[model samples]
Target chain A: MNKQLVNIKNVTIGYQSKKVLDSVNMQVNKTDFIGVIGPNGGGKTTLIKSILGLIPIWEGSIDVNIRKSKIGYLPQFNPFDKAFPISVEEVILSGLSGKKHLFKRVNKTDKEHTEVLMKQAGIIHLRSKAIGQLSGGQIQRTLLCRALISKPELLILDEPSTFVDSQFEGELFEWLAELNKQIAIIMVSHDIGTISSHVKTIACVNGHLHYHKSNKITAEQLAHYECPIQIITHGEVPHQVLATHKH
Target chain B: MDFFKGIFEYTFINHALIASLFSSVICGILGSYIVSKRMVFISGGITHASFGGIGMAFYLGLPPFVGAAVFAVLSAFGIEWISKKGNVRNDSSIGILWSLGMAIGIIFIYITPGFTPNLMSYLFGSILTVSTGELVFMGILALVIALFFILFYHPILFVSFDENFAKAQKAPVRLINYSLMLLIALGIVINIRVAGIILVMSMLTLPQNTANLFSNNFKQIILYSILISFAGTMAGLAGSFWLGIPSGASIIFTLTLIFFMGKVLKILIERLKRKQKQFLPVK
Candidate 1:
């Protein structure tokens, strides 16, 4: 196995005639919990999309140690309406799509593995429920199961807490924290103060890069840093805000 | 009972009815995707493109089903490619191809140097003359589609719901897209005989659209769609026999009547549930 899990070097990612991320370079090591923070449309999602190879790598390279199939990803929003009829288990099982044969039957082991992943994500009860019937938090857990189902070497999530509740967000993060033993995770979030404490690395992607070690972040540095911190600090420092970060 | 048995005694009637039933099953299953993906427009485009295939087959003097399948499949691929490339919005591509395919088809038919016959049957199917070969072909296609759904069930569901997440999982999205296209072509080609170009899209869409209102999941809706499609087709076929009317018109009328009936049944059930909820003690 390669020493570096992901080595994205001098990559420029964009859509047609619209350059989003420029000269982005990042090296992900083992057990790295990276937090990406920036404003909306600031190429946070774009950078993640490029990493997932959703868009073409226009200028440079994004090389993962293993095959593209081994990576797990969760998007900011699902591009589907409630009309889509898929069970949570079915949706999660698709994470192992690349590993399974299209025509071959799924075995008992696959079912057991799916159940185990669901249990890990705290959505075992939702295994039988339709994904459309799930609450936002439940949906997030189901998607997490999908990301973890393949035992991915790297897990990438973009704005995971955007639609989830504060309590669920913390629980979700705590649940994600358990995977720090085996998988490297890259999370895109605007919840800077809370998330930075849990992560080992912080990446400020606002059409560029401001990568730093996590514990190095400070309120003073944030006031000057590139992330959207002004909108975050709303007047007097509430105890819950500080506690959520430190706890 | 005697009258029904008398009708059943004829091999032609049995063959045609069975064939139509098989076609309905495939349409009901495949049509739900057609409706959900908002690919009604694409299916409409294929309806027009089938004319081109029909014309070419007549000119070349070969099996039009083969030609229609080839033409429809190629157009399906083209539509898939254009949607993928994002060159233009889906509507424009569908409109352009739809019209061009028809014009070319009409020109081919007009230049054939003889009086055109059986054109109406192609435009609007004549159920009176369905061959056994066509019936078998439809059965095989329906089975193949059903099997395809049974396997690779997850990826198809994922891709249909959310392509971004599907890609994140590195699913064979393009392959799934192609598979869907191929299945759509299979559905159309199989039914292009019993259902005409004029009324096929309605037969494909109406039942599933109606069933979608009543069911919560894909499996239930699919089962409902198939049952509903079968009912409508059978009712229409029976109506056509009794009234001496056009089978195509009869089939579409059956679907329309079923739609209204389904709405009535749904309203009654909803009202009953509300009344029960109102009367019941709080939990």
Candidate 2:
């Protein structure tokens, strides 16, 4: 059965007075791997924020079928202060935080779970290292482990490849593919060529949403959907497929 | 030996020692959070804003600490509320409160009809003059803060590190933020007696920065900061006694000296380890 995880209906959201997303409609199923692509300031991040309930919607509803806690989120790679004194293990374990666990200490089971997630994420060796000591890829991996520690039913990653190396990007996609067997995934990225090959469907968001059923999308399709993004194909001879400009 | 003997002989010295101990514990824990969360500016604003309360209290013939506490808490909450609204720039709002509070304080003090209130104690601190009531309050505050940190350690860490992630996990982010802000305001006001308003920010940040050089672990930094704070306080007390200097100024000077020393030592240790590593044979 295709279990519906989230349904966004006529969703309108934005910063005050400036609408970023309007009448945005999208449905995420249990096994759906959605790649959200849009130009900069094109409301892709706003759509996700609305879906995550981080911002208030001006009009419409976003229904999350699963428990809100079961939706793990990996926010965009912010340039965090390198001097922040926190260990990788501590950062990962923070994922287990909830109303129930607020006053309680992290027990042996939680530690064991963190260890297992770190091992799976290949960050077990760096558990004791502070986040400042880790490379960008290592930090991304640590955050990935944190996003997974809750055993979430749906994972939301915002430009996970932004600060990572190519090697880690490949590994991240592979890991995401493996995780998608059991859970749904919604990834926002500007790299159309890369994400198109990995995602099961595509959502072109530019003030609104155009949900494409198939991962394969043409430049014409992107232009038709009003998503202005360059498509850089990877091959022996790298080429760029620029969307048709109306102006 | 003389200092140790003086602690047993002089009641003022006894009060100073107890005040140092309690203030260290309170500042050490809150300082770690302040440094990690990068809320030093907000803390400074709250500290300065409390001066308004002091001035108002002086004018109204109320205890300065009471006025300071009320003003500090109100400004802290105001800053928190304003920042949440996202209407004004965070730093600009802080600047407004910081200067506004100071201006209000000066105005109140100037208008007061009594003999000129001695502002030195409030501005630069007089640790030796700490009262028994203040000591009791500090003791209770230390206990409460310790209990709060112990019980909500993980949640606090989670929220401090990444507020959005904590919120997504259904953590009480708002409650924790407001509670910590209240605690921070109270901590700043109480410690004003130990380190005057001008030097209190250093007390909250210097030791934590020194500890950060040695260990990047949050808990370790807190522990190290507490120890370092006490040592600096003691050393500063001794220096103040010998040099006939102000206790608060001496304490801040010692802490700054310690921070520089720690930085140099960290550099030396790293160089030594690098040199040693170069001599090792390849595996």
Candidate 3:
């Protein structure tokens, strides 16, 4: 089996004349867990959006070995209208939607699969509940189930840890680690400290991408990479403010 | 009993009842979509814009509903296209179309020579005077909307809930959106005769909101909205006859009353549930 899932080459993307990412290159392979860390508007989301075909790239090619439907995506939370009158089960089942399922009713087999995914995500009890009634963590889990329902070869998540509590965040990384054993995973996150412990590799995205072969990245190395994000470490001390960096 | 007897005795009353049923079916189905997708403002813009078409039709000596349909469809597509292009803000574009359409309508009506057309019936509605041709058209629209919803339920629901996710899934998002917009325009035009232009939006919104108070399921909301809208329309018709009030205003009043009642009932039920939960043994 071909291990390479996606090969993004020299991709330049932007929105309306303003280039967000320039000459970004990355390779995703089966069983690879890449933790993407970047500042706000640092082309992290733009890179993923280009990969997902959500936006057009100005220059470069993204060659995906798997079909588009084979890549599962969990977008950032809170952008969706919470009061939308859709149940958790319905949201999960929508993952199966594509050109083929447009006119077709969701089958019993599809529903059974949704239930199984919900059970795995530990949100089966919340299946009948509306999305508005869910806690942030529960909503994340629900969206995770949606992303996984397609049985994708590659799973792409955008800031899955944001809006989730610490406990669920821990649980989520554990789940991601487990999932990485089967499918390639590309996750965008701001919590580099937590991500460093879980991910196999690290990619620091600013205007460009600096892919580190190992997950263990030092502040010195991050500075060398020109990635200006602060490294947040947890300890008994209330907080440690790092000295301001010179431009 | 008098209402039932009147329905049989007078053809106009019979027409009014049929018109109410068709209006309920059309408004209920489309209203659920409008409210769920939060397109009430856009729909409102389209509603007002269609008046421009009505005025133009009056000036040209064509049927007013035909002009309304053309104007409504154009404005609906215009708003969708303009917003998609991202040059102007969505709300700003809506506002432009909303006022522009109404202004164009007024200007045309003002300039049209001969006896001034009765604007009250078009603005407020005259369901009691609904014609057979209008009823047939409404019946067809109701059938078409019902079929569209039934056949494309999942696509519609998915698209409405999360548009980007639906696009990523490759669910024909553009086609569904444009088709629905077209239907919305046509639905608005056909029902203009039932509730008139001014009172029509309430017919499309109030029942759906009342249904939403009870259920958060899209399908359930549609079903409940249909039933609630029908009940409201019938009750409003009776109230209009009894009180000698305008049918359109009375219908809207009744729908608003029903919505408040549903709201109060929901609060009561929630409070009762909380009290009952407190009585349960602490685990």
**Top DockQ hit:** 3
Off by over 4 Å in 3: A232-247, B281-283
Interface RMSD of each: 2.1, 1.5, 0.9
lDDT of 1 by residue, B93-138 (tens): 9998888878877888888778767888878887667888887788
Residue B232 of candidate 1: its Cα lDDT? Answer: 88
Ranking by DockQ: 3, 2, 1
lDDT tens digits, residue span B103-206, model 2: 99999999999775668899999899999999999999998998998888888888888888887777889999999999999999999999999999999999
lDDT of 3 by residue, A1-247 (tens): 6489899999988898898998888999999999999888898888888888889889999998887878899997557899999999999988887888876789998999998888877889999999999998899889888888889999999998877888777778888888888999998988777787888998988887888778776666666656654655643323323344322
True A-B contacts kept by model 2: 0.78
Q: What TM-score does each model's chain B reach against the true chain B?
A: 0.95, 0.98, 0.98
Top-down lDDT ranking = 2, 3, 1
DockQ of each: 0.52, 0.65, 0.71
1 against 2, candidate with superior TM-score? 2
- Looking at model 1, give its docking quality level: medium
Question: Which parts of model 2 are misplaced by more than 4 Å?
Answer: A232-247
Off by over 4 Å in 1: A1-3, A99-101, A116-126, A223-225, A231-247, B1-3
Q: Is the docking of candidate 2 incorrect, acceptable, medium or high quality?
A: medium
Preferred candidate (DockQ higher): 1 or 2: 2
iRMSD computed for candidate 3: 0.9
lDDT of each: 0.79, 0.89, 0.89
